[model samples]
Target: MDLINGFITIFSSPITMLFIVMGSVLGVVVGAVPGLTASAAIAMLVPITYYIDPLSALAFLYVIGKAGRFGGSISAILFNTPGTTAAAATILDGHPMTQKGQAGKALKTASISSAIGDFTGEILLICGALTIATFTKQLGPPEYFAIYVCAFLIIGSVISSSVLKGIVSTLFGASLAMIGLDPITSEPRFTFGTIELYNGLSLVPLLIGLFVISEVFTQASHDHSKDGRHDTIKAKNPDDDHLSMAEVKRCLPFIGKGSAIGSVVGLLPGVGSAVACFVAYGEGRRKAKNGDKWGTGVIEGIAAPESANNAVSGPSMIPLLALGVPGSTIAAMLLGVFMIHGIQVGPQIFETSGDIVYGLFAAGLIGIVLYFLIGWFGSAFIGRQIDKVPPIMIYPSILAVACVSAYTARSSLFDVGLACLFGVIGYLMRVTNLSTAAAVIAFVLAPGAEQALRQSLLLSDNGFAIFMDRPVALAFFAIPVFAISLRIYSRMRSEKTPAEMLDTA
Candidate 1:
């Protein structure tokens, strides 16, 4: 079968296997460092793969994705900082568990949950890709445009803690994404005639500045909570770790629920890991008989987030592989890396790169085994020791990686400087509660929307009614209507609360 052939190609060459191993290790390191994420890790490594076989190149990135999913938990448990937003929920109970000296239990539950969730996602991805390929063969740009509108509405409404802020963020992102090239004429519309404005702002450097560098600046301005932790984190040893089986059993149910939540949520483009975790935790507690005691360092509290966040890593790849639509902000960055490497995604990818495609799938399966080998066999020694790394030392190393990634993603030193500048802006955005997720989502969907809008208009002889000509487009328009209705209803209901009336007055 094609799958077997793909795995053979990946493993037949010892070089490919070596890269997988190296990438997994490096991914963990990147994920461990606060501010650095899996997407940045893959981008930093992508250029290194240009000369290698495509299968090997993909294999390396696959490992990074797998390990990066788990790596974020390392920081979330050790410190309150989550390396990825997916791990944000992990800090809710993980850091508290660590403070309680139940660090081993928390880490163990997290590791197992992550592994199971990731494995489940891989299964769904393989199945979904095959089905999607068969069903979507006839999809046109108009269909894609409708999907983009749907995505904007869903992500804007669901991802934001505040729907109003979320809606605003989505609009802001769209406006910025429209800054450079005109989709129809390829003429510059918003560029003010400056060379710097011609290309619009680059996303990778902007992401680096906003997510990684800005956090460093923000942290610099604050007086951190002091536990007098060590400056540098050493690599964890696989030996000398310990855990009780009773605790492991207690976490199993949570892991199962988390994985289930991840598999379902990840199928959507905008949900991402953070949403998965919060949803999983809420659902798990809702389903638990001992729900009242859920937050007091229970295994369920730890396992739910650990499973959901990691599970997303595999399923999030579904859109990227099937439609070239990225499911998460990090996946968007990886899409750039794939483009840079001359790897074209979409239905044809399976036909053209069966070996590479299959290899990536097989790698996810094998990575589970590798994760267990590292996390289970080595946690006691690695977990306790890794917990001591302070933010000051860890953050700078993240900036270094981001700088390298910005340069690598674009092959421009200007990207590095731009990333730093964006870092400052990102920091300010965080302080003001502006949504970076909104911006990233906007960047990814903007080009497609513009292309579709123009194409549809041309086909319709420049009539604005083109959007309602198709059932799909009509449904897409319903999104804004639905979102607005929900916002209004929620607002009207909220008006009766004493706190709301006080704020309004």
Candidate 2:
């Protein structure tokens, strides 16, 4: 009944529907462009949420996140360039099909598989988030703090090729989070006498600088003028342009397996769509009848990765909705939106904002359908259109929009300057191969972690011995230790193989 009302809420508003439509279209356009990502688009548009109703704002951005995942397949298939990191796995078979003049077939396969996978993940989210929240709500400050520690370690360890670099990025973000007044004492710590620093850094500027403006800086340094253009391959036959029932049947098993893999991965904090897609692709290949033919334009190859890539969109939100922990960069951005709207996330969110939560879920379903149709009927056209606009032109416009968006957040010149400063910092981090996503997630989680730790300590009668009494907290703390150990063991084992070492690098 709540879900139905949620649908009604979205349907009742013409403006909300319009935003969903616009977001879907824009998401595809943005994701079809190489070197642009859904995260950057969401960061640039976050300020616009301040002017709209919470449901409308959440729906708009949420839909874009959904649609954008599918849109990345457009460029991956058409140009061999992944519009987003998640689409990297798709290129294995996607571009090969395009080179074989079966681009339409690959695109359609991707569209169908992505929709099915995303739908599966959404259903799991709607069913599982509330259930998980029930248990999460029972947790005390000690358990919450333990969960935070687990997240920090897992994210820092897995997000980058270099575990040390990833941990450093996480620590850097945590340090930045400590720059303002102490939450408990209300005394300033690192303000350095700047009044603006008293409030710490605004998420708007940080997000814009790290994801949006930094990309602009990176793109600006690249010489797009000398980049070679690849022409879109035309289908050799009408059948090559349309997905057949036989093809769908053959791809169904891979799609299902990929969706399952993606949903499970999404539930784990810090493991993202890129990992899910590649894992799904590898698993599908290992199990497929045509295993040897996996990489040479097999439709199953496209089905596996595309499905898993988009499937991560929904279940990744589970941690955010249930435990107030963001599992991915997109979820971290959404966390900012939730705070901006004065909506509390986590277990209490269902009781406090059920309508908006369910409506967001409804919006996600509608978005999946919208993007599926667009991908099926118009992806080729959208891909060609994006190809016409060179990166040299696209990035400057994005830089301008990012600056304006930053200023719009608080209408402050200082925020804009802060954004530019972080832009340089972000550029350096990217060039240094550090995990910006890990840093952003840590920045968002640090305050809550600090509060939980302080609160737990305040309640403790026996100092550090309090954690010893809590089994759940102990279990939570153990997760990161186990994960880090497994990662180290795997790295040690892989070191013996030169090819595996190269792949790991």
Candidate 3:
């Protein structure tokens, strides 16, 4: 088959194999360090790809993104610090497992789950993108707006312990998104005279400030002893170091379900691994036999989020390959790479760039294997190294990297100042139990949602009825209404006392 031939072609090249391995290793190191992201790495590498073969460039960056996501779990499990936003939910139970001296088992669970989930999503991308693209191409702005609204409501409702706080946090993000030039008019709405503000806040600064810098502040407040012995927590027993067959069997179902959720979420533009991981975690908890123990250092907790996050990597490329639309920031960078190579995307790409596409797919398959082996064999040593480093020394270095990374995104000192500002705000949010995760995701989705809604209104003379006129849009609008009502009803029922329940029964 052509697919088999593609695999052979990629495997025959020694340089391609070397790049895959090197990229995977570099990605793992970068992801394990806080404040550095896969997108940033790819952004930095764009110029380097100019001299390399197109297939090699694409393969190297693609593998880096995939491996980086998995690498995030290493720090999340061992240090209670998630290097990436997607690994946030992993901290719920991952750190607990470390405290229980089962760091090795947690690492293996993350590795195996991530590999299986990535494989499933890659398969879906290969088989289903063409079919999905045909349908997605038909969707108008109204339908897209409806989808964004649903995501906003659903994510806000599920992410926080308090629904009001969650919704408020999301709205705050949306409001900040309105600070730049209007998407429709190109008129500055909230620029306040600064040229840098004209483009609005960069995502890189906001991300580093919110996740990485805020975490540093949080860790500083903790009363961790200076004793090096507490730096690294080790497995308490031989049994704690290995993942058993029973544990793997118990986790298989959750891994499969997480993969499915991630694949579906990935196909939608602007929805990334951060949302997919939490969504998968919520679903896994709902179906778990020991749901009450979900946040108490369980294997399923690590499995669900890790699998779902990595799964998003593959399917997130679907829009790019089939529709010429980049779904995430990484995909957008890859788009630039494709353009540089003069390989057109979309439906016609199959005919014009068949060899490159197939080779890219083959590289993804191999990259998964390489990263899995690396994670499995290298995790213990990595954990020990982290443990050996003192917090005082490590955090200052991380702070420097955070500032530098934020500046490198745009070569602007103003952006560095903006990052520090957000760092303070993020620290306050963390202390207040506000959902920074919801806020960040909402910020990412806000511009697209606003554009879609505005475009739809312009296309119709009947105002909001344009949504009602479209059955798909109508259904999407109805989903949030139904979900909110159910949540309210459940809360009402749960508020009743035990005596009231008994009397009603």
Candidate 4:
């Protein structure tokens, strides 16, 4: 079978297997460290992909993201601090369980739930991408442009605390995207007579500057002079350290619901694990019989958020693979990897790059097993080790590596300087509540969107009427309208809550 052959192809490469294992371990370590995320790690390492084949490069980053999602729960349960925002909800009940000396039980619940959720989402990705790609292949420039607009509006509306800030960040990225050759006429617009500016900006440096170097700057600003100590509570009884079959049965419903919720969220552009985990936690608590006692060290609380967060790792690739749209920040980084390898994404990828696609799918499957093994068997010890490392030591090394990686992309000192500049901008954005993820996605999507819009206009003398002629384009354009209406209605409901309570009184 083609499926069997595809997996076999991946297995034949020893380098790919080696990187998968290395990535899993590295992801776990990085994710266990507070303030470090899988996105930042991948951003720091994207330049290294230049030395490897596409299959190995893609596999390494893909596994890192998958493993990193599960890794965050370790610290959340042990230290009462979430390494990633996706794990923030886990601390609600996870730390309480640790306080109760049921740390192992809570950890097992998180690990198994995460693995099942991730597997479920990956299955959906494989089936959904191929199916959607079949239809997406038939779409023209008008429909593609409409879809891009819909993505932009919906993503900006949902990702940020303030919709205005999100839209502004997205537009800012689009403006930066205009600094090179014009998409339609090939005229240089903002090159400033510099050869380096001719290509606009390289993605590797931008990613390093924004996600990796910015994080270093943020970390450096924190006080790391105090000695760190481990005060992890240990389980006294065997029952406290192991999850029984009865407990697994109790968690199955929550796991299933959470996985489904995460898969759906992942399919939408700009939605991330942080949102999915919280949503799943809320839904799980509402449906449970023990809902009233939900936050009192309940296993279901840990299961719901952990599962949903990891489930987001897989289906987030659906938009990128099927429509060449990056749905999340990690997916945006992966888009850069795809472009670097000279592989065009979208429906044509299956036909022209089938081997690479199948290899990536195989790697995803293997990574799930590898990370699950690590989480299930080694997470407790890993957490203990992470708590011992001083923040003062870890960040300086990271800063040095980030600078070196930025320069390696083109051997240009200018790129290093540019990365530092963006690092400052990124820190400011973080403090200002602006969505850097929105900016990154917009940067990747804007060029394609502009080209499609221009091509559509050239095809029709009637201007915007071309979108009306295509049913698909019209439907795509309508999505943002519905999204905006729902957002406004939600805000209105929230604003009216106090008045309604006063009236009742």
lDDT of each: 0.72, 0.91, 0.79, 0.88
What order do candidates take by lDDT, descending? Answer: 2, 4, 3, 1
Of 3 and 4, the candidate ranking higher by lDDT: 4
lDDT of candidate 4 at residue 460, scale 0 to 100: 96
Off by over 4 Å in 2: 496-505
Q: What tens-digit string does per-residue lDDT give for candidate 3 at 1-505?
A: 6567668878898888888888898777667765456754654455566668888999999999999888888888887878677788888888899899898899999999999999998888877766665676678889878877876776567556667787888898788888889987899978889888888766667766776677778777876674343356767799888999999999999999999988888866556788788888888988889878887899999999899999998888986787665656677667767866888766567667878888888888989998999888897676567556666666777677778777775678988898788888888998998876677767766887898899999999999999888999889788777877886888877986423432342
- Residue-level lDDT of model 1, residues 50-79, one tens digit each, is 567776777777778778778787778767
Tens digits of lDDT, candidate 4, 1-505: 5456668977898998999999888888788888999999999889999899998999999999998898899989998889898898899889999999999998889999999999999989888888899999999999999999998988888888888998998997777788888876789988999988987888877888889888988888877766467587778888999999999999999999999999999888888999899889888987889877777799999999898998998899999999998889999998999999999999888889988888888888888889888988898989988887877888899988999999998888889988888889888898898888888889889999999999999999899898889999999899989988898888877765422432332
**TM-score per candidate:** 0.84, 0.98, 0.71, 0.96
Evaluate candidate 4 by giving its C-alpha RMSD to the native, one decimal. 2.8
TM-score head-to-head 1 vs 2, winner: 2
Against the hidden true structure, what lDDT does model 3 obtain? 0.79
Best by lDDT: 2
lDDT of 2: 0.91
lDDT of 2 at 397: 86
> What TM-score should be assigned to candidate 4?
0.96
RMSD of each: 5.0, 1.8, 6.2, 2.8
